[model samples]
Target: MESKSKKQKMSALEQLKKFTVVVADTGDFEAMKLYKPTDATTNPSLMLSAAKLERYHYLIKEAVEHANKVATTTDEKITEAVDLLSVLFGREILNIVPGRVSTEIDARLSFDVDKSVKKALKIINLYEERGINKDRILIKLAATWEGIQAAKILEQKHNVHCNLTLMFSMVQAVACAEAGVTLISPFVGRILDWHVANTKASYDSTNDPGVISVSNIYNYYKKFNYNTVVMGASFRNIGEVKALAGCDLLTISPSLLEELENDTETITQKLNESEAKQTNIDKINIDESTFRWMLNEDAMATEKLSEGIRKFAADMVKLEVVVEDFIQILGK
Candidate 1:
């Protein structure tokens, strides 16, 4: 019994959970049950992938039936089906994770603040209809200028929480903080991808541009006393995950979560308020024009943001096709 106890050790993932709230970044419920993340985040791409699975086809059928009952035109039915499907997935995930589920607004609405806000309200209403409280949901927006503004209105006016995603720079992060956003998902792997593709250089976790971006944002938020949660997202590897051991939250993919669970490496806190307070970082207030100008100035950020939006939008289109096909089958 002494030898067995001596052999026991906490995995790197367990160590990470001590300092950071680990969020599962996949649509797979099985993965969520295994890793047991405090939160789960989903996007059009992930939903598109999950909707293709046979086990989840029931969800698609249910969504289609709900749409047929509520909507008039074919386009309207498709839209309703998509929205209902997202909430259905969120509802299912909420049952498993025991925390909030982030159901994203349509990426096509990323540039339209009014539409985004309306859709968010619609999503929240869907959740509420199923006895899920609004507090249990985080409406995900694209972190565009319009998205940030929508979040500001939702948070201040409607009492809705938001998670700003596709963020790649301090300009976006600072703007989000100023807007009193509930959370901001600064993507790490995508930033590293842009730098590597542009400069043709390799990077490790310590000096990774993505890691540096999140660390800087985390420090800035802490130093300035922002209440917004910094959730480091889109990690490419466990090394990047380990580097951000002390982030407020880290939404990791299942593959990386598996890696962390299998390895028993000791990790230390890399971010803390005490260290952040000691840093010589200056705070900058970002208004609309300055936000636009700053984002325009950062080539990598601009490119990546546009690319991320387009990819998500394209996947949303693909999801529409899937819904349309399923609707046809039902008609047959």
Candidate 2:
């Protein structure tokens, strides 16, 4: 039995877990086990890194073999292989975590609602065929106008939940909630990096642009009674994590998870739905044009969204190359 004072020395990670659903933002199974995250998120970039790990090397090989049987051309094989790899990673991560695993659609489909919807459904079907129900998976899409529209369709028609990623602006959050998307993962570290690079100014946890962005969106969602889950993601440091301690969810990297485990700082709940409801906030929704204009007005959000999409797409391309190279080797 442990004494009260001894248990009081709980690490910041444990403390934060008390307030928010701690999510492992990595594709590494060991990391998810290390932190015991409730949920997990993976994008092309994370998946690309994970697919290359020696421990998980078999996944890409498996994908390559399956693709080789079904695909006729290098381009077709690469696409099929990557898609299968995404679901493979999702399945493995789901087995490790008790909650949902987010599997993203290719970022190249970010602008086409129909293609995004089709690709998302294909991923979900792949998971379902593996005996994993749609309930335990989130079809992650970019938070573009088209992506949000596709999410709405998935949520309403197919009963498949969606996780809107690359979210940066309040307008994006607002639009996502209005679309009845299951969740939105706002990029916290990327926002902070943008501010730091351009402004050449320092930021503490309290006034960190990333922290403030998530907080504002959290409060707004609570105020308006939106059911969309606000997940703060892509964290740079533990301070940013500590500041959004009470967010609905936060996807944190393994490196920062280690930092939280070592620090025994007191974690406080900063944002509460009850408090937000009592605060003054206007009911708001963003139309397509308004959404575009508002997003354009916010330079940080605009730049980050485009850059994020490009990065994800580039990773997808790189993953394709790996698959193609592996396929060529097998042909020898």
Candidate 3:
């Protein structure tokens, strides 16, 4: 009776946490505190949303002041301010979560390897100045060819960790693992969005294209003995989150986390290394040309990756404008 009562008392969230690391996928500190995710991830869009809130205004002010003190030109100030703001949020998140935080590089720098590497290093430097170590930070970059290369340099040459975002296809995963990147966040919901829009069909959790993509990537990584962490991101529904329950990690929004917490039903492990290793699969080495060609061949991956970059880049510009407004007010 006691064991049965204890089992019944466990929420699905607690049960799921037993198998996988639950990462809060929002910039909301309150949500992060409530969910107590092991790690946290932030992007331009999430940061932009958080910046508009009154509670985060002080962070913006500090970032602007830091930028003004260091940078002479308006362009330099905006860049510095945005980077500082990202680090500031990351710092606060680190205080709440015991694990690391994934702070993004400027999305516009996604295609330029040199610029991306420089920006990543700058972000890491900013965090270090705040007394945060390199090990507790994961610099997020888009999974473009150049972004992967930049991550390679940061990981191998500089010993900085990286989380490659905007991932959709197997090619991106293979390339990231091959580059010795630290982690990869495959946007599960976005892939499902692409398939649903094209096919005009509804999918259950089991048959979700996004879930399948992550599962396949997980199996492949386990099969090949790749150490790159697979953290599923951008979930659209609780069903999708439930489907990828046993992923290495799942970065879920606060809403889904709440739902999982409220539901008392126990969930099953959907992915495990033992079962993954037994799956029959072939491995393909992804070179620069092969990666591009394969990515181009998959219309879904091609369109989604481009769209994700463009959207994040657009939000980055909007974030800069927010910083500019702060700069004007603070300068006055």
Candidate 4:
């Protein structure tokens, strides 16, 4: 006979798949296993945090040893170290999750289309050499105009899949779809953060700018039959997650995943194409000049985009320092 606790405990994975693809947006492999998310995502910030934990010590040590053995220069060592760390995390994540894992390129290269594409391909190759198939990896890059263009070439020419990150507007989403990228991660919490600071008032999910942005993107993709998957990311609260109940995917944090798991309340569908057709939303095609001008005009978008990049870049540097310190301790 099943215990009351076992009977009452609902699976977050089951509820998550009904509305959106469940993605574990963390670098902690043990936590990821407990939730059993379908997919997983990692940024420099999450990796830095994970490396600080005692449980992930071996990953840093191994990365340093690998770096010392094969790298010809300091720059090469850093690159090799980052690649090794990314693969270590990816391998650990694959053990827990059944779907793909997103490993990001350096944020500092977001504006350099060619460099971003090359780096992405490098990371994918590293994973491949380890016997991990390409299908289970999504190269995560920032959604700069150049980044999208790079993704276009990578998809059409190289046959590599991508997940465009730090996306905020319709223009970016439209460009990604046209580029034939595999997925786009529209940040829900970050958008809400912009709205709250600008409006100076608390916002509700139904009418929240962030919630509406993702809903619009999801509907647009579905309406036009774009195969690009829209995975809503950077969630601040459960309300934002609930608001985007029907997104193609939602990469949520473990805390919110826990909340959803504990509650047994009914969840409802929010956004769909059938409803989208009823609303009047004009589709706009964007060129490089227009895209830049539009981004320049929107202070919130411009500021948030730059801020996100800097934060991620800083985290990457910090992670490198941690790796170096770990190497010294390991004598490699």
Q: Which candidate is the best by lDDT?
A: 1
Candidate 4, residues 1-332: lDDT per residue as tens digits?
45676667555446656877889899988778887889999999999999999999888778878998998666677778877898889988998899999999899999999899889888888889889998899989888899899899889998889999999888888989989999999988999999888889888877888888899899888878789989999999888888887788899899888887776556777876688657766777788998898888877778888899999999999988887776667664
User: How well is each residue in 214-295 modelled by candidate 2, as lDDT tens digits?
Assistant: 9989999998888998999999999999999889999999999999998887889987889878878787757999999999
Cα lDDT computed for each candidate against the true fold: 0.95, 0.92, 0.94, 0.86
Q: What RMSD, rounded to one decimal, does every model reach?
A: 1.4, 2.0, 1.9, 2.3
Provide the lowest-lDDT 10-residue window in model 1.
2-11
- C-alpha TM-scores of all predictions: 0.98, 0.96, 0.97, 0.94
Model 3 steric clash pairs? none
For candidate 4, report its TM-score. 0.94
Residues 79-100 of candidate 3: C-alpha lDDT, one tens digit per residue: 8899899999999999999999
Writing each residue's lDDT as its tens digit, candidate 1 over 221-251 gives 9999999989999999999999998999999
Error of 2 at 175 (Å): 0.4
- Alpha carbon lDDT at 248, candidate 3: 98
Query: Which residue pairs in candidate 1 have backbone atoms (N, alpha carbon, C) closer than 3 angstroms, thus clashing?
Result: none
Q: Which stretches of candidate 1 lie over 4 Å from their true place?
A: 1-7
Give candidate 1's total backbone clashes: 0
How many clashes show up per model?
A: 0, 0, 0, 0
Show where candidate 4 strays beyond 4 Å.
1-13
